[model samples]
Structures are given as structure tokens and as C-alpha cells.
Target chain A: MADTNETVLDMEVIGALRALEADGAPGLFAEIVELFLTDTPPRMKGLEAASDAGDMPGVEAAAHSLKSSCGNLGATVLVDLFKQIEMLGREHAPEEIPSLVSKSNEEFVRVQSALLNTK
Target chain B: MRIQDGNDPNSVGEGMDRHLARYHELKDSGEMPGLSLPEPGNRVPASSAADGKLRDEIIVQLCEGVADERRVQRFREAWTKTVEIVSANRSGICERFPYDEFWSHSLACGLAAHALSKQLGRGNAEEAFLCGFFYRVGALALSCAFPFEYAELMELRSLSELDELKSVERDLFGMDHVETSHAILVDLRMPDLLCATIGELAGQADGGRSELAYLVLNAEKIAGVCLLDESRGDEEWSAIMEMRRELGLERAEFAELGDAVVRKWWEYGDILKIHTRAVTTFLELDDTGITERSLLGLSKINAMSEYGSPLTVLIVDDDPTARVILKQQLVKVGYRVLTANDGADALSCALQHSPDVVIADWMMPEMDGLDLCRALRRYEAGRLLFFVLLTGRGEDEGIIEAFEAGVDDFFVKPTHQDVLIARMTAAKRVLNLRRQIEEDHRQLKQQLCRMAELAREAKDAAVTDSLTLLPNRRYATRRLSEEWSYSERTGLPVSIVMIDVDRFKMVNDTHGHDVGDVVLQRVAEVLREATRSGEVVCRFGGEEFIVICRATTREDVLLCAERLRSAVERFVTEGLAVSEKITVSAGVATRDETTGNVDALVRAADQAVYKAKELGRNQVCA
Candidate 1:
């Protein structure tokens, strides 16, 4: 469980985010964490729907959006899974995108708890 | 400083000649570093036979970079040759010409004119550039023509007005720089419009000046501010502010133009191989108290947001978090921020606020960023809006497509605060320049329309009677000539019905000129209303009128004259107690073979009027 947690979340990226706090007001990081928690679910759902319908462009766009949101909060493992899904969609490999999309959802669950703890 | 002769080293003192000779000896022996060129007296002709084309090409390149092609071509040949002539005799010209100050000022002036012309969108950028460069050529020509006298005259420039300086120049050198510049331009066969515009700068007041002339004037003032000493009288900071207000620029934007002028001046100096001194920027001198504000979070925002009406930015994203974060960043940097959930929402928000900039995410549900950009561009106000697209993909093909849809800039998300702030600053600058230009264009168009209306009024006043509101004698004569020529061409006899108010002298003596004027006005109205469209009735002079009848014979004119006489008799003059009834004596004359010309016909009518007066008052005669 500790090894999986180490791979899933990047503490150094969270420290950099903390440095962006204006005179230690404690709003930017919480705001970004809240945004990531709200923004990723709908995008992950759209990525699954696009994979089911074989909509390559839609899958690419949704995965790309999710990847950017996750990367902002230092969800590196989930970001990597979504990046692979985005590439599969871009390259028209619909067969491989669904597996990666499911794996991304599992990793996103862990990133959400880690972000909630950090907040 | 007074002008110096470069060739005469002994002019400075006795020991300088020996040092100069020794320096030249070492220079010729290649022991000392020097430019390898012919001595002052040993140079080629003004044409500079060798490397002339290369020199012209260099000048052409420099000019092309500074001004537009069409305007540059108008004076390109003459301008290049003048530069060559000056360069060939540079030492001699430098002896008389205040080379350093004049060169720097002229270069700055030309650059300012080019930038100003483009900014105003007047389509005369090149003409402005040429005008600015040659504006002070008269001083150079004067110096060359009368070096000693012109040098002494230039000393009075700071102390005297333009007219006073001209008078002094006339006393000393027999002519001033304005006249000399005019003569030089005419000799160069410059465009008549350019010559006339630059020649009219003799008067300093801006009233009754052409737009091109004003452009040159302002360009010179801008150059004065840029290159001259800070304490110079004509180039004071207040003068720049006044011109800025006249140009319809906010304080911040005017400082931007000043910075551009200085930057371009240095670039032009490099191209022309002239030395440029360090310039204190207009922005630096303009301490608007914002710079003095403490560099804290909220205080810095307060100081910056107080500058000249804060610009608004509309942030659009399907994601709520992206929208909120971006809005917060923009608001932190003093931007008035509007938020929207999607592209459709952004369009409505933009319409309500008319935001200066729109930043929207590309991948939206119904109307994406590209579609939103296209939609905004369809509106008249939206066409000027600065649109930035936020995309996750920074693909080249996508950027090209986005640009085709009218996106001004692009930002990738998740956005960095620093990058967003930088983009906002750029947006503010571009928007300010565009708005200033638009205001200037609108004002210039209105001024042109007003000037056209005033000119029409002046023309009408010149040929119209002041009191009677009828055509004056000058218009009558011109109409008579036209009618006479028409009669000769078509074999039609034209008739003239001359009218004179009866007992008009008594009316003036009894009342006053005011009542007499009213009497004449009443009589003019009678003649005007009674005459047909084919006849032209004019107040020939005081209490006298003439009706020109085209295609009318003598018989017809007699009846027309009788009709006018009866109409005047019937007109009861109101508001005049002394002269209640106004009547006129009418005389008719027709063009025939006996009356060979217009003057003879007019004379025949005059005699006929006298005959009517002698026979009986208020009667018609032929």
C-alpha cells in the first residue's frame, strides 16, 4: 500500500503548489484541489463513452483535459494513465484506450483521497 | 554650439594644425586608425560616380523600413540623391550644418511621422516620413548658402518666435529656411501637394492647416521632445501632453508611442550609420504616481487598476474551476474580469460587458472557442476585440485554423499565473493602440466633413447677396456669359429684365438703411416668386435686380418685365411705416445681331431702364 501510494502521488509537486500560496493565505492549493475533484469525474465519464463509441477525437479531447487537470494537482500516476489513453485515441487505437481508461479511473480514486488529505 | 569647419584644424588654435598634420600623416601611413576616404576637397561630384547605386540602395532600404512603399516612392529618387550629395560634401556641409542635432532630430521626426501616419491610418505614412525628414532641409540649405550669416541667425532660434527668426534671417541672409526649403523642393520637382503642404508651416497656429501639415508639425514636436535637451522651450513635456490629447490618446498610450519613437530612432541611427545618444524615455519622465506605490499584493493592484479606465477581460470555460482560477489571476493583475460557463455564455457576457479581451477554452459543448471567436468577429465591436484561445493541444495545424477564425493569441491550459498576466499586459497595449487609432479616424472623418460643409458655405456666401438672399452681381455676370454662349450656340435669343425700386432713395432718407433693406428684400421676393424657372433673378446691386431670361424673345421679355413690375407694386412692405408700398421700374432687352457681345446687351438693358425711369416711375419699357 505504501509503495502504491508513493507511485500514485508526488509530494514535491504539492510543495511547489504550496509555494504559490500568496503570503500563506491558504486558498490557491485548496481551490485547485477542489477543482481537480470536481473536474475529473465528468471528463473520465466522457472518455469512457468515447471509447465505447469508437470516437477517436472525442476520446483524445476528454483524455487530454483529464490529463492536464490531474497533472496540476501532482497526480502523476493517474496523469500517466490518461496520457496513454490520449495517445491511443490520437493514434486511432480504440482497442487499447478502454483498458487504460479503466486503469485511469482506479488511479484517480487514489489521487482524490490523497488530494483530500493534502487539503 | 556654433557650427565648426572640419577641414580648418588651425581654426581651433595654433597647435592644433601641427597635431592635425601629424595625425593625417600617421593616418596615411596606416599607423593610426581612420576612415579611408578622399580628403574634403578631393571628393567626387555630388553624384558620387562610384558606389552610387549601392548608396542609393542603402538609402532605399532604410526608407522602406521606415515608411510604406507608395509614399516612399514619391520622394525616393530626390531624397536619395540629396543624401548622396550631402555625403559627398559631408565635411563642407557639416561645417555649416549643425549636423549632430539636426540629423538626430530629423531622424526622430521622420520615424514619428511614419508611426503616426500608420497609427492614424491616413494612408500618407510615406509622405509624412518624407515631409518630416526634409522639414529642416531649409536650415541645411541656408547654412550651405550663407554659412556665417546662417550660423549667427541660428543663435536666435531659442530666443525668438518663428516670425521674428524669419525676419532676422531675411535681414542677415536675405531669406529664411522656410523659403529656402520651398525653393529646394520646387527645384527637386517634388509633388505639388508635398511642396504646398510643407511651405504652409510658416504660421505656427494649428488653425486652417491641412491634416498632412498638422502631421508634420506634430511629428516635429515629437522629435523635439525625443532628441533635444529636456529644458528646451518648444519641446516641453506639457506640449507633448497637449498634442497627445489632441491625438485622442490616453496618457499611458502616448507614453507607449514615445517609447516606440525612441526605439525606432535608435534603429534608424544604426541603419544610417549616425551616432545616437542615450535617450531618457517618455515613460520614465512621466511619473504618474503608480510607480511610487508599495510593491505589496493589494496595494500594487490598487495602484495599477487606477490607470485610465481598467480594461475588462471575459474568461470562458466549461470547467468551473478553470474559470474561477483564471478570473482570480486576471483580477489580481487589475483586470476587470467576467466569467462564463461555456462558449455560448461567453458570447452573451461579451455582448453585455463589451470586454476588451476574450479568453475561452477551445473544447466546449455547443459553441467552441473558435466558433465563439468567429461569432464575436461578426459584430462591429467584436471585430476589434482581442481574442485568446485556451487549448490543451499546442498543435501547429490547430493554431493555423484558429488564427483563420480570428484568434489574436493562444494560451495553453492549465494556465500559469505569470503567463496569464503577461498575456493580459500585451492585450491591454494592443487594445489601447487600436482604440486610439479608431478614435483618431472617427475624429478625422468628422473634421473632413465639417471642412467640406464650411467650404460650401464660403462659396455660397461669395456669390450671394447678404441682405436680399439673391445671387450677387458676380454670379449674375457669370450666368449672363453662360447664357450668352448658350444663345450663340443654339441660335436662341436671351432677354434681360432689369429692375429698379421706385423712390428707393426717399425710402432710405425717410427711415434708415434697415427699412430700406427690408423694402429691397420685399421687392426681391416679388421678383423671385414672379419669375419662371427658365429666368434667373439676381439682386444686381442696391435696390436693383436683373432677371436673365433664356430662350425668350423681346415680346416675351416685355410681358415678363410687366409681370415683375406688377408683382413688386402689389407687394405691400410690412414693418416699414414710411414706405408701405414697394414698386419697381422694369426694362427689357433681347440679344440680337446688333448687340454683338454680353457687355453690349447689358448696356442696352441699362439704357432701357433709364428710359423707363424718365418716361414714368413704376413702369415697364422695351
Candidate 2:
């Protein structure tokens, strides 16, 4: 796995974290990352399976869930990956699923590792 | 330490150093107390440690403590002044400001600030007020500091030239005004985060902040863009993206803010009264912020009431009385009117104001209305201008020539005021309709493109026959009837042909249905080859085909149908297996004045086809 420092968080993310801390919920940071790590993988897998099976609704649901999860964690890069996946799913481009799934997995792993290291 | 005189300076100097050290420690630790310190009247007596100079510095610092507050106040004043000036002298400042960006930005910032305040649970009107006010401070300051640069920047004539401005500013000032202002804000002891946000707003290099920075930066950018009089470049857009990335802002978030901002600006008059009043007070101190505010306010007011509508009308007439009459009438009708003495002045005025419409007199000293019309048609900006030429001679040939020169509507000279207003109102209605039609057309085209894309992907063969991928029996019959009705209504001839393969079931039994399908496809191909443009060929159920031709005569239809029959027979006999020779029987029909309905015509053709099949296959009967 790549080092956490290699994945630099945007200043906005840091500021939001600081704001969250100011709101007296500093622990929300760790909680959000944990939720993302726990929830995102299953959703990603489901998205891939749904795409492979040409299950458009399922693909859309999974992609949407992953997108919101990434946003909550302030995982911007992951959010973008999920957006592409969501677009593809909405377009019903099942053929594009495998590559998008792999790319998203890589981003998720990067974000996950960074979050763990931060904790 | 024990034996100092009461006025000794050494002890006082040491105490001053100690106090200074502690202040720096608090500042660095990000724990500075709120800026609302004790008022000067409530302060304890200063010890000998603090002298007059130190006290003066402290007073300056204290005043600077409310520098953000002061700056915000200044910005509001400038904004109001700008709105007023632009509104009053619509010809002068409207030519300069164009009322595009300022309108958009004011709206966006107002809304985003409202949302952000709510999100932060700040729950006060101050944050909402500040959100709209401070959001565009960077742009306002830049415009004030470098008016000429801003005017040039607004022109945005070329990307390379814009970059040159950036480089020039850096070389001349060591930093851009955006950075300079941000640095000044920092020096004045604003919150570090807000200072960072202001820096980002000024289009400085981005650093990690949160949505607040993104919010401010985006608001400023949108406001800057809203204020822009011309097109921006890739560098500007890239800067925006980089800013977004640094602030973790999505395009949708910005769009949402933009929508909210527009809504707020739309209601700015009601919502921003207190801020506007404060800004008015600040404007009396300095002239910078008032002009912008005035122009913005004018635009808002004009946009709200039809009586003050900002749509420009360029009046071109050499006669002073005529020009005055036209301007007064247009202004009375709520149009922002510009008067030009002749065609030359009119063209320049048209280029500057980009008026929604132009009313021009025919004969002039420098250039005639016809010549101006021709010239305007050639310019890209002139294409959308609603040109209404006022001709002394409204003769048919002259009118045709004016139409050729791209005059959308025309008005006769010495026209009555009521008549002129009616014509202009008609033109406005037509223009509005044209806009609606164009919008609808664009939406329809997009939908069609999407539908076509989906159709290509689905590969459904029901509407298209399975064998030849031509229109099936149902689609063919429907299309034929449509063509027939169209031709009948237009009093044009319509033609139809029905073809049937001879002994098709025998071929299917001899060589499996797959081979028969291939033969059917081959015959269908031959039929397709024989048909002309604007003709339909389709599989009409098993072993049958139909063709519909438009504007065709009976002789031509017969010849075409005969050719199709011959081609299919020759192709099948020469190209197919030796065990079977294929042929087709065809019947052709043409509609004349006597034909009452499309179905009767088809029935007549079907009878002829049956006769040909019965007499013997492999021939055409009409």
C-alpha cells in the first residue's frame, strides 16, 4: 500500500475537518473514515456485479451510495471516481464496468489507507 | 532593580518587551481574543512603558481590527454607486458595464452566503449580509485599484495579452493587487482562514482550506466572470478548476451557489437595505464602492419593473427633433435608448451597446441605412440586431432590396408615434417568439440526438424487418398512406408497387428457411436498388414487398416496377442454386385526381398484383 502522506488532502477538506472539530465533533473525522472504509467496498462490489449483469438500477444505487460515502469522508478523488461510475451506470454502459470498477477500487484503497494512517 | 528613579526608562523598556513577546505568542497560537476590546474611554491609564508612539500604533491597530468591517462597508458603497451611475447614464456605463456579470454574481453570493450561514448555524442575518457583501470584495478592490487594467481585463481581447497583464502587474508591484489586498487584510488582523479565503478570491495560488475558501473563491470568480464584458480564456478557466480542486468544491456545488446567488440578487433591494445604507455612509468617505453599487442597483431595479427595462434601443436619424422624439418615446416605453446622429454613429453605438434592436433612417450624410444594414449583417455581433429601416420610399423593389440587406422589419418615414410603437411592439413579440422557438428547437434536437443514439444501440428489428433491415409491413403501410395523403393534398402524383416472389414456399422447402431468408434478402436488395430517392421499400409480410414513390407518373411507376421485377428474376436465376430459378410478379398503381382515399389506391394496386400473380409470375401488371 502507498503511504498516507502521498495522498494529500485538499485544504478545504482540512478546513472542514477543523470546522467539524470546532463544532465539538472532532471524532466525526475518524468515524466518517471508518464508515467509508466499512461501507464503500461492499457497495463497489455490488456496483461491479450489477454492471456485469446489466442490472442498471442496481448499478445506479450502488454508485450513488458510494458517491455519497466518498463525499461524507471528503475523499474528493474517490468522489470523482464514483461520479464517473454513476454516469456510466446511468448510461447503462455495462461494458465499461470492469475498468471503472478496477480504477475505483484503486482509489478506494488509496483513500482507505490514508484514512487508517491518519487514525 | 531596587534603586530606580520613578521616571527611569530602563524598567519600562523591559516591561514593553515582555508584553510584546506575550502578544506574539498568543497570535501564533491562534488564540487571539475577539477584536471588540475595551473602548478608549474605558481603558486603564498607560504606564510609562507605553509612550505616545506606542499608543498611536495601538490605536491604529485597533482601528485596523475592524478593517474587514470597514472594507466590507467600502465595498457595499462602491457597489451601490456603480449601480446608480450605470442606471442614470445607461448609454455611457451600460456601454462599459453591459450588466451581465454583476447581475449574476450579486445573485449567487447572496444565496450561497445564506446557505453557508444556515449550515454553520450562525443563525444571524449578519453572516448572510456579509456573505453577499464580502464575496466580491476582491474583484471590487481590483477594479478600484486598477480601473484601466480592469477595463482592459474586461475586454479580454486575447489570452496572451491577459497573461501579459499578469506579468506586468507582478513586475511593477512585486505582487498582484489581489495578493496585496489579502496581505493587507492579514496585517490588519482578520481571521487567518478568512484572510486565506480572500487570497484565494484574488486568484492567488491556492492552499488547503475548506468549503469556506471554496465558497468565497467561487463567489469571487463567478462575480468576476459576471462583471466581464467579453470572453475569457483557458488560463482563466484552468485557474478556476485549480481553485476548485484546492477547495474541494464540486461543479454542482458552485452551480447551486450560482442559482442561489441569482435569486438573492434578484431580491437584493429588499434584503440588502441595511448593508446598502452602511455602504452609502462609507461611500461618503471614499468614492470607490458607491459607483459599482449604484450601477448594480439600477440594473436590479430595471430588471424588476418593466418601466425601467434595460433593453437598449439604438435610434439613428440625422434630424435632431426626430432623434429626440424617438428617444423620448422609447424611454417612455421603458427601453434604455441610445441616439446616433447618422449611420456611422449608429454602427459605433450598435457595436458598443449591442442593443436588442435598431431603428435607422434611410438617407444620411456619411452612410445610408441600407449600406449600414449591409455592413451590420457582415459583423458577427450585428447578426442578432433587429434592423428596422425607415425608408422614405416604401416601394416594392426598395422593400425587397431592404429585405435582401437583412432588414427584419421596416417602418415608413413620417410614421405616427402610435404606428411606430405598434410596429416596435410587434417586433418585440416576434423576437420573443423567435427566442422561444429557438430554445424549443435546441431542446428537441438534443432529445432527437439522444433517441437516435438509443435506437442505434438497441438494434430492435420489429419496425425494421428481420431479413433486409428495411421497414416492415406495418411501418411500410403507414408510411405509404402518409406519403399518399401528402401528395394528394399538394395535388402531386403518388405511386405504389407490390411485389411477390413466385414459388417462395417451394424454395423454403427445398433449401432450409435460412437459405430462403437469404434469397428474400437478395430480392429485397434488388428492389432497393431499383427505387429512387424519396421512395420507401419494405418487406410486406412473407414473400411480399411494397414500394411507395412520390411525385411519380403512371408510366414512370410501371417502368420502375418492371425494372425491379426483371432485376429480381435475373439476379435469382443467375446467382442462385441450379435446382431453383426465382421470379417475381409486380403490380404498379399511381394516384390521379380521381383517387379519393389512400386505402382505395392500395386496394386497386393489390388487385392488379393478384391479376399478375394469377396470369403467371415473373411479370409486371399495371
Write the residue-wise lDDT of candidate 1 on B130-219 in tens digits. Answer: 677767666665565556665566665541134366766545543456655655565456677667776676434567888777788788
Candidate 2 similarity to native, TM-score:
0.25
> Candidate 1: where are CA atoms >4 Å away?
A1-28, B1-307, B449-622
Model 1 chain A: weakest 10-residue lDDT segment is A17-26
Candidate 2: chain B TM-score equals 0.28
**Error of model 2, residue B215, in angstroms:** 31
Give lDDT tens digits, candidate 2, residues B1-622: 0111332325445422322332233345542211212322343333334233443442232233244665545433333333332233222221233233343444445445544444344423233333444444333333433456555565763222232455444443233434444543454444444555555555534576455554443445544433333233345445645654554546555434443343334334222221111011001111111122222322123322222234567888765534544554455333556778888777655754567788887656568888788877755457666788865322345788889999998776445545766777777766667667767987998898678758865864237775687888878877877887798689888899988888889877755565577678778888788777967888988988989888888998898898888888777655443257788999988887787777878888888889998998788998
lDDT of 2 by residue, A98-118 (tens): 787888888777776677766
- When just chain B is superposed on the true chain B, each candidate scores a TM-score of 0.36, 0.28
lDDT of 2 at B536: 81
